[model samples]
Target: MQQGSGSLVELLLSADNFYELVSTIQYLDVIQSRNSEAVSELVSLTDELALTQASLNAQMDEAEAEKQRADEARDEAEEARDQLEAKIAAQAAAEAAARKAAIEAAQRAAELAAQSEQQTPTFTTESGNDATVEVPDLPDPDIVVPDSDKDAFVSEWSARIDAYLAGSPLAGQGTTFAEAAWEYGCDPRLSPAISTVESSTGRVCFLPHNAWGWGSSSWSSWEEAIWAHVAGLAAGYGGQLTYAGAQKYCPPNADAWYASVLANMLSI
Candidate 1:
């Protein structure tokens, strides 16, 4: 009976062990199921993190591209501005240089005029009397226009004078000479003919603006010299063209001078 009881207890313990083993196996299965769910969740989270990282990287690259474009645009704008400023500065400098050159030219012209004014000539009357002829302060050339009588005289003689002086330095002064002759009651052809004889129509002169070789004279401008010489001729030579006048004017070569002057007057 004791052996039978021991056998029954061993069977009961074995059955309990079998029940515990079954319970432990079911717990392990539950743990495995939970672990599988957790692993799926972790894998899903890792995939989501990788996607987020990829999106961040793409955004960063786009932002970098935008910054580079903005930088390039800024550089282009700066370059354009610099080129525009340089052009403006160059134009201003050129204008300033032109103004400086004009001022220098005007100053030089004034200096030459002042130098000429320092040397002038004295005149002699037909009666062999020495005289200091004062130049009339004539009106400016811009303001002076010939009247009807002077205009007629200029029209008649201007073309002739221009033709005679075409290749000479005294070219283009026909109207000035004609107008001065009319104003001073001198022969229009007398002064120009004398210029041809003495100074080769102002191609050469012993003094500044002394085209007629009247004396040791210098004038600031040709207009002033023309008027002064005409006035002197009217004062001393009776404003006429004559052999007597030529003899009194240049006794050393009166015949040749008079003949040349007559021929020039006839040609005119």
Candidate 2:
């Protein structure tokens, strides 16, 4: 029925209908054009949004990579710091141990020196001549036979002592003692002197194995004494000792004790 009514109105209003139809056609055309433009703008905006999203994703990836790199660097730095700290700790420990050992050695030496006055020092020489001597004792007659008459004394005593030790026991019996004395590479006359001076004229040295004044308890045997003696002489006289710069072992006075000790060796 509504369609029939619209048909009757169309037939009755011809001129009015033409004008209305033209206006409606013009409005529809404008509306359709505006709608098309809006659709195109929307599509363009969507493309731009997609591009922006892609760019944001790339930036996020780069930022994540940078963060990962920074974290790795921090971890490496921490590891390096830890290693340095460990090395420092180890060095400190080693220094402490060295200091402790030095302290212990010094203490032992002090104790030994204090307790060894009453007892005599004793040890066998490399030449196989064994005689007990007192610490800081009177001079032996054999050693007292002056250096000027040293040759004759050496010849006479060497022959006698060699015979006694090697089974002769006669002064002019044979020259075996002289040969043994010579074999020891040190003077036989000086040997008695060394013993007497250190062991106290057959009384006591009481220091463990320091009979010939050759060692200070750190040395163990006669061989060590011999080597130490030889080395000491060369080094002491030739300015080879580390402490004695530009001068040999001979120094004046008891104040320079290390040097004085070096000089006294010749007397022994």
Candidate 3:
């Protein structure tokens, strides 16, 4: 393949933008072989020069052999030293380049791994309400009535439906309304059941784990919603709010009423 830019060595040697240097090292071995051939060629050239000097000496007499030997020795030593030094320098440069490339690749890998960890989102849930941790699907976006709100239960449930569809942040802000309702002496089940009564099968504003239409219930931020339900009931659910003497004010089926209100709280 054609190299897009500089020499293979230059591209492979860069520390910050290097890859494939190891594979290219084998190519260096080939270059070393070529360097060896260069040494052979230089030796042959020296021999040819010596033969020329010897031929020139054939035109002279006596101590000519000694003179030629001395001159040839000096040239041979200098030339051999130059070639050895140049070969060593080239090898050292290539090795340094390869090592720098490897180190940069490793550092890049580490940086990418760190970035991956930072990018991944971590889910979080408030404490004490395990249901929030494993909430199922969110309910439908809108809950419509069955062409009427004439029934007493339907009308009462309808009021809370507005709050649920509003996606009130009070409960989701931190507190499970159940704890709030329980603390304020209102049945926790009442909220979720209001949702069911208004929007059966989670069709109306199907929020998950929020039966009370509160989305999330917490007394800390949603003290008003909690107190509202309490005060609303205290104003007299069917003329009297007190739980005592409940038999007189409540319909004949008190157990069934709370059941239909917050079915999820039936176990509670």
Candidate 4:
């Protein structure tokens, strides 16, 4: 019919539409084929869309699982950091306490030492004698006497000298001479023997009880002369009986003086 105007069913029914019917039927067949191809393409597209949706769901599940694991790991790390910080805080507190204690102990020790230096300590002896001796600052004594007073063998020699001087001016004075000789550390017989040679056993003298003929020597008493002569003999002539000592005592008549002194000593 007219180019493309009427329906195919209406064109088929007309006497002038014979060619139109043929053309229309052919067009209908072609349209039916295109519809079948469109339907097949639509089915393929629907199947691909379903498969993509499943894959997206699976990726979402995997992402959710990874996020959960990351959260758990973050929680564990936080717990470890908290425990470490707690330990550090505890150690710092303990160290601070120790330093404070050490400083306090040092301060106490310094105080005790200062107190001890200021105080004078009292010393106690073991014998239970509690006499508090107040020792004053005094000058030293001039002489220190010995605790013991001994005879020095003077008593026996004094008795012998007394027996020899029976009736002389120096009677009963033998012990005095012996004491003086003991003090001077000389032979007790040396003085009496020298007296016999110089003054005939002290019966005669130049002056004032000078029994020995010592040069310008005198005394207020026989006791004084005895001490002076014995001290001189010890200091000058020495303690031993020798020819040299005899010469030193009597240089002018050493031989006669020595002989006479020795003879008198033998008699005693």
Rate residue 241 of model 3 by lDDT. 17
Candidates 1 and 2 compared by lDDT, better number: 1
lDDT of 2 by residue, 1-268 (tens): 1123354346334335667666655655787799999999999999999999999999999999999999999999999999999999987676445434433433444456569754332233322333332221111111221245546755775554444324211223224323334443334333333333344322344444344444454355433443454344334433121223212221221112222222232333
What is the C-alpha RMSD, rounded to one decimal, of candidate 1?
Answer: 23.7
Off by over 4 Å in 3: 1-62, 118-268
Error of 2 at 116 (Å): 5.3
Candidate 3: residue 142 Cα off by (Å): 72
lDDT of 4: 0.63
Best by TM-score: 1
What would the TM-scores of all predictions be? 0.44, 0.36, 0.21, 0.43
lDDT accuracy of residue 207 in candidate 3: 41
Residue-wise lDDT of candidate 3 within 100-168, one digit each (tens)?
Answer: 443343344445656887532211111111111111121111222223223443344334433443453
Output the TM-score of candidate 4.
0.43
Task: Judging by TM-score, tell me the better candidate of 2 and 3.
Answer: 2
Candidate closer to the true structure by TM-score (higher is better), 2 or 4: 4
User: How many Å off is the CA of 220 in candidate 1?
Assistant: 1.7
- Predictions in order: lDDT: 0.65, 0.42, 0.41, 0.63
Q: Is candidate 3 or candidate 4 better by TM-score?
A: 4
Lowest-sum lDDT 10-residue window in model 3:
127-136
